[model samples]
Each structure stands twice: as structure tokens, then as C-alpha cells.
Target: MPTTPRIADERHRYILEMLQEHGSCKVAELARTLAVSEMTIHRDLAHLARQNLLRKVHGGAVLRNYIELTFQDRAVQNHEAKVAVAQRAQSLVRPGTSLYLSPGSTTHEFALALIQDDLQIYTNSLPTATALARSAPQGLRVTLLGGELVVFVEALVGPATEAALADLRLTHAFIAVTGVSLEGGLTLYTEEEARVIRAVIRAARKTVLLTDASKFGQLVGPQVGHLEDVHVIVSDHIPDAYRQRCEQHDVEILLTADLDVMPTSAPGAAAADRRN
Candidate 1:
């Protein structure tokens, strides 16, 4: 039978979703999943690449941004940078404090880097919750949000998740984003996840954003909130433009290189040495 437009559209949709979730897909794997030939998968990848929806590589295709890799891929992509950010972010975590952690690879690192025994932690990420449950010290408490599971991100989201966070107030909310820019603020691939992040931000007295240099100055997807919404940002590097923007927003930017100094008592009130 000839390849119908409807079947082609469905295949294209599946390909895009796979790229968005898994970061990339091989021609043979896609063909097998769709019950089509390698030739058909090749055509689909080519079409999507031409549309700027994806980038065709040797025998596979990746998301348009090229760097929007899968969670597992991203975790290893900036391993050192993530560790640095996680280390610096952990400095802000005081003993006996309650905090919420948003889903993402870096936040997962933050979950692991955490050593505070006297703390309460809540998360929507299955991987992070499991890590905390398995390795957390006796004084630490881990709460996993209840809702629809998003396997791609390994997080629970949707209205039920949001409702679970409604009545609680935490000392801090540590979050990760797909991109961050002066104009677009914090962004993620889906509004569903963004909605849950917004809830996390609201439930916390303070918000800390965990991201590496790659996320700087880019706009990825739906807006989670502006830079002003966050109390602090922990990253491997902060671009000059973001420095000025953060100063204007009264948002503190903590660099991994300068983990020697502790966070200031007041947000954005860093010592002269740490000011942008």
C-alpha cells in the first residue's frame, strides 16, 4: 500500500515525541517501532529536518536545539558542571529546613549531593525520590508527589500533583530548567511540567534555580516564571548579560567556581566580592 498522509503524519508525530523524550532516534529503531521500512523512516527524518523540527544525524535524528538531550544523556553531558552547581546549591540548604526539588538531571544530582540529615525534602521526580529514599540519612524525610507519571522526565505531574503541593509551605524550592533568558525567564519543554514547577515555586518561601552554562540566554519553551521569581541561581557560569539581568531582578547568581563563600544571609545581598 502507498504511504498515506495520515500514516505519515502519525509517524512524524511519534518521531518528534521520541526525539523530545529520548533526545534522538535511530532509523532502524524508529522503523521497527512504526512497522515501516528503514526507507520510510529516512524519509520521515528528512522531512522533519527540513521543517526545522529536528536535525538529521548519521543514522538518527535529534531535537531542533541539538542540545536538548534526554535526561540520561544530559546527566552525563555536563557531569562536572552539574556536580559543581549541586555542591554550591547544597550550601544553601540549612539543617532542619524543608525544601522541594523540581525534576531534571541537575536536580537529581542535587538530590544525591545532599548530606543534610535533619531536613525535609519533597519531590515530583521518581528517580530523585528513590535516590533520597535509598540513601538519605535518618533525619531526612522524603515525600513524593502523587499524580500522573511522565516517564520521559521520570516525574509526576498534572492537577493531582499540583494539589498535593497546595497546602504545604517549604523553606526552599530547588528547580531546574530547560532554558533561561532575560526575556523568557525559566522555560521547560511542556506546560504540564511548567505548571507543576510554578506550584513548587509558590509553595516555597524561596526559589533556587539549578542550571549549567548551556541553559543561559536561551528560550526553550513555555515560560515558568521570570528571573525575579527566583531568589538564587546556582550555575557553572553566568553570562555577562545575565549578570546585569540578575542584578536588576535582585536575583543572586552563585557560581560553582566560588563555592568557597557561603550564600549571603539575604538573597541578592552577596558580599562585594560575589556581586556581579
Candidate 2:
């Protein structure tokens, strides 16, 4: 049967979400959800499998060993949410402060939001360095850690990078991660990158984990650091469970992103009917 006309990119994203939410989704269900034929759903699954984003099974598709999205793809994944998180992080950034920008999609967006000058920006991400070059409204000092670049991750890691940041001091370090589990603490995929981030955290007087709502409650890969190691967490959504854990650890949680303004009618519609 022929698949209905659907945006290829959108369908892939939707399928990914469906799988994540359900843990596994059958082709028939996915087809119904997307209003496409089984053949189209199979094709979508095949493409995502090649990207290592999922594993195709007999009946349908299941999650892979990890989520291996490229930096560029992840950057646009939840763009507005990232921007809102970036703005919240900006409130903590003052002129003349030194920031250790770690490698991640959210941190890259944070780099884009940075506008102050007379500040020092240190990072290992190629995109973060490039973004700061363009958007720093004032004269800024940028430092790139010396290391062999991880092309896929678009950042520097390994011994050279760690050594370079050894003596450096930072006012703040914006840490990006794959998941946050109460038992596992802060976690990311690669051990090398995890060690580098921990070093950056040690150098900073304050550490703020910049992440989105999606990362909450996920437990994956290596444990980067303990919850108490961080001072603050800025995310789009902080669930009550997470809020309780953060409070227990003495970690401040800041929810700064307002959701999209999708009103059924004109503005102020909700307030119109509600009178005292």
C-alpha cells in the first residue's frame, strides 16, 4: 500500500518520540499514528536505524543502545526550548565573567545567547567557539582547549584538553549532559568527555547544569558526577520528583522557559471569563 504524503523529517521525529515514550512501537501502530502505510513506517525505521538512533525489530522498532544524534541535528531538535534555557542561563552571566562552555547542543545555544564583552569564554566545542566569535557584542577573549578533536561530537577531549584547562579558573561552568538520574547522578555517554566536564566543574566556583525537560529521569551511560557536586540546574521543566531530589541535594532548580503561546482564540481569552 502507498504511504500518505507526509513531511519526511517530521515523520522521523514523531516516530522517534513514539518509540521513546512507549519503549517499543509496532509498525502497525506507528503507521496508524502517522497516518501512513506500514511500508512508509518501515522505511522510516530503516533510516533511523542507520543513524544508530534506533534498532529495527521483527514487528517494529525499539530504542538502540544510545541516542547518537549529531550536534547539528540535536541543536534544532528543540530549538526554542534551548533558546529559552539559554536566556535563563544568561541571567547568571555577568560582564567580565569567565565561562567554561562544555560540549553539547544546549551549551552551544548558550554560547549563542552570550552577548557580554570584556569576558573570557573557554570551550572545546567547535560550534561554541564559532558562535562566540560572531555574537559576543563586546571585545571578548576566547580560548580553545588543545586536544585531538572528536569529529562526531565536535569537541576536544582526551589528555591534551584536560591538561590545558588544569590551571584555568572559571566563574561558571555550564554543563550539558545526556541524562539525570537520582541514583546515577549526572551522566553522559563518553567517559573521556565526562572526565573533561568534571575537570571543568572543579575549576569553576559555581556549576549550573543546562538541560531540557526531556533529559529528566533518564539514566544512561557513565555517571559524570554526584548531584551535590552541582550548585544549580536550569531546565525547561523540573518535575516534582526532580524538584524533591534537587532540594535534597541542595541544588537550586530554575525553570525559565515559557511554553509556546498556542491560544485557541485571541490573546487574553482565559482571563476574559475569569472575573473576581
Compared with the true structure, what per-residue lDDT tens digits does model 2 show for residues 140-238?
A: 899988788777789988888888778888888898987886665776656677779888877887788899888877755455786667777888888
Count: clashes, candidate 1: 0
Each prediction's whole-model lDDT (CA): 0.81, 0.76
Residue-pair clashes per candidate: 0, 0
Best-matching candidate per TM-score: 1
Lowest summed-lDDT stretch of 10 residues in model 2? Answer: 267-276
| Pairs that collide, model 2 | none
For 1-276, candidate 1 gives per-residue lDDT tens digits of 889999999999998887665555679889898899999999999999889998776667656773445677767978889988998888888998989999899999999999889898899999899889898988898889899987778889999999989888888889999888776578776667888998888788878899999988676655688877888888988888888776675677789888454343454354222321
Query: What CA root-mean-square deviation does each model show from the true structure?
Result: 10.1, 14.4
TM-scores of all predicted structures: 0.72, 0.69
> With candidate 2 superimposed using the best TM-score fit, by how many Å does residue 21's alpha carbon deviate from the native?
19
Best model per lDDT: 1
